[model samples]
Target: MAQNLDDNYKIAYDNKAGFGKSPALVLIDFADAYFDPGCVLYAGVDDALASALRIREVAHDKGIPVILTEVTYQPGGRNGGRFFEKAKPLSCFVKGQKTAGFAEGLVPRDDEIIVSKQYPSAFFGTSLASTLTAMGIDNVVLTGLTTSGCVRASCVDSMSHGFITTVVRDACGDRHPAPHEANLFDMNAKYADVVSEAEIIAFFRSLKGEAHG
Candidate 1:
């Protein structure tokens, strides 16, 4: 572990992608399917949920755009394709299913943009990139479930789409710890800067000229 975090810092992972001028916060798939304890996809993400809510409140106060993502599949799972076949749990989002809805207390406001997606990457088959680009958003603060899946995909795609990406570590969870930690390390080393929920709140506060990080 030290070999990756401590030893690689000066050479293999020297770069630190910092903050940008304009930022938008995105909560990826904080839906019932992933939060319901009875659901197979549930990852016990209580801490992540609370962290996201806190960061979101700060972001909202700072006038930073808040974007929410939810997995939605068409009838008979036609929109899901291979991903659905691989993970049948995805069927939970089928059309009118209640599990497809956003979890309690995590619903998006009427003003916030909600990206309805059927894939891991929110940017795929969604208008999120163009919307952010139109709003002149140069940074993306990510929060969501299954850190190794949608969160990881969104983080990488955020970078590939030219945004200074920051993944809130405490606001992202996974079914298992290994993949979560591994992906966080990998994403920080290459795609996004992995930061804490408090750090992100500080960043938002700084934007409002309240306090500095």
Candidate 2:
């Protein structure tokens, strides 16, 4: 007989990971090149931006460690390696350019850490894994642009690094819905527990209470 998504897909990959006690908030590439309507890389997914802002508010309130990533490259894009060759859009991140910086309101404060990366996986050549480990972070909450690319890669790497990964579904977006939905579904099944922004906010609030009280 036929079955629903739950009985078929969900049951097999029924690993629903939970939020860890010490989870770091990772904002991935929420930069001008991705959000500006005038820019070619614009994803047309504004909901994710708003959700990410809300998530950031709670992250600050809870005093959670917030980390951010930027897709920056050198003057000739020499540091990006093969990735710099493949995506011409990466030229937007050349240093000293207007579009190379983080998007407004997504800026990192003095206390937060900003990890600049040249590839999709933030942990590849960066000190992300070691930084998280140093901070005693056992879980990672992800929010960012391009769900199918950097977000997906980071989720996989986060799990492989032995950290519980959680992707705020509404806080991530793609240039299109097809890859966006497909990647989120796959991440929930394997790499991360794709959850709603409300769920993530509740989790942050819970942590705030524990941290303060």
TM-score, prediction 1: 0.94
Instruction: List where candidate 2 sits over 4 angstroms from the true fold.
Output: 1-6, 208-213
The estimated TM-scores of all candidates read: 0.94, 0.93
lDDT of 1 by residue, 150-180 (tens): 9988888889999999999999988889999
State the C-alpha lDDT per candidate: 0.88, 0.87
Residue pairs in candidate 1 whose N, alpha carbon or C atoms collide under 3 angstroms: none
Once superposed on the true structure, which residue ranges of model 1 sit more than 4 Å away at CA?
Answer: 1-6, 209-213
Q: Looking at model 2, which ten-residue stretch has the lowest summed lDDT? A: 204-213
lDDT score, residue 59, model 2?
84
Residue 186 CA displacement from its true place in model 1, Å: 0.5
Q: What's the C-alpha lDDT at position 47 in model 2?
A: 79
